[model samples]
Target: MPGLDYFSFAEMWSPLFLVFMLLIATLYAFVVGPWRQRFGGVEAVPVVRQLAFYGAMLLLYLVHGGPLSLLGHLMFTFHMTDMAISYIIVPPLLLYGIPGWLWKWAFGRAFWKPFRLFANPLFGLFAFNLLFSFYHMPDVHDWVMTHYVIHGFFYALLLVVALLNWWHVMCPVPEWSRVTSLRKLGYIFANGLLLTPACVLIIFAPEPLFAVYNDPQVWVQAMGYCVSGDPARLLEQFEGPAFFNLMSGREDQQLGGIVMKLLQEFVNIWALYSVFMQWYRKEKSQEDDPAFDHAASGRLNNV
Candidate 1:
């Protein structure tokens, strides 16, 4: 008999993971509030920024530490959903939530010169897409899911690259920004173009592209990453991912590709809109401001 209890809390509740999430939240609260004065008189973050940080952490827990994580191991579709939320959505929240002063302090060190290279609008666009695409290559994918440590390390790298990719556009630290309005627009559009090939390959592949979903042996081993208990018992109880699958593996892979692209598009579209609105408002503000010179001031006021 097939079962999805491997993804069920009844069988595999992750209390340790829950504790870890709570610990992070507590740390964030202290850092942005009572801990600020201790950090060389860094001011408290705005309430809205505080909410973004907390909310991002909460979503991280829900998606990665709770049922969604188990679901990710269960199916490729859910796995892509996990990636979308974690890599695409969470980093922006973090960028926005952290105070600019804190970012200044962090990147002020000489160690970040390497990050500056990757964080450039032109390079970030190419680097993030290149790394992201490489990670999905079937050979690379098999190697990672087979090794939990490598899997964790690879995604951690992706998260870092993701943060760098978004830096030029949403850089909380003003001094760090390297792109102007036109370049920002070009950078985002280029990113969308660069990433499309990965999704297109996944979506159009004639067969399932990932070993973790298509091969029962690899699938079972991958499940071991999430499913707890004895190997012998686990093997006896479950046959493969089919035990938990609701759709054919091919369909699952295709759907996963589509979902990833759509999620990426949604985030990019919002980013473009935010950039446009900010630019519009800035131009409006400039037009309204009276110039310092008398004649210029009079002309601005008349306009």
Candidate 2:
């Protein structure tokens, strides 16, 4: 296999993006630490939450601007791995990491009230899954990959909806959470169900569905988004995406689908376990409450 070392420095590490991400981390530290009082933060953010936030940023940099981003362009499987990490894993971590006070400060305004409709669990659930499925449609995927501006805008939009979708599952602000614990489990299941069809289509296709992976001309055009030079030169230098791919196009596509499905299932199972444990703990606490014990004794005596 051709190593990523063959790629240019900018292509592999994306120094500018790394700097931008570092700046974001620095700003988060200031806002949550020094500027907490100014931002209406009454208490310090938890250490665990801060770590989660930093971890999410690291994952974001890895998939979006790191070597994985370059590899994604070369192979369908890597692309799907990026997608799973970006949308499935990263959003919840980000939501968990930020302080509730920060979230409230950012979105508590009257101006945001109207837009809060977009945060509805049902709206987020359906909109994100639908848009995600639509994006994977062979023609749509090819088109988005080739158009730089559209590609950027659409992916940003997707990330926004992904955050919205996960907000229900891991709403940072407890008081502001709309979905109940039981309902959240249902929501997670529905998300898994909704995403299955897109994975199924990709996995079961008899041949490669995406022209960007199979056709050298189309691959070069799509490579324009990541590679700095004239994309046509990619054809001259490396032959095509196949030059980088270790597997046949069909095998790569199938593996990509399986990877996506498995990652989604793993995340969902973890979510289910987390929610169930939370519910169990809450129930146990209620059962052990002194008030509850008195009330139960009274009821038994009356009976």
Per-residue alpha-carbon lDDT of model 1 for 5-98, expressed as tens digits? 4345733557777788789889878877777765543566889998898888877876767777777776889888988898888989999998
- Rate residue 269 of model 1 by lDDT: 94
Q: Model 1 — TM-score against the truth?
A: 0.89
* Model 2, global lDDT: 0.91
| Every model's TM-score | 0.89, 0.94
Residue 263 in candidate 2 has what lDDT?
99
Worst 10 residues of 2 by lDDT: 294-303
In terms of TM-score, the best-performing candidate is 2
Candidate 1 least-lDDT 10 residues = 1-10
**All-Cα superposition RMSD per candidate:** 4.3, 3.8
Alpha-carbon lDDT, every model: 0.79, 0.91
Winner by lDDT: 2
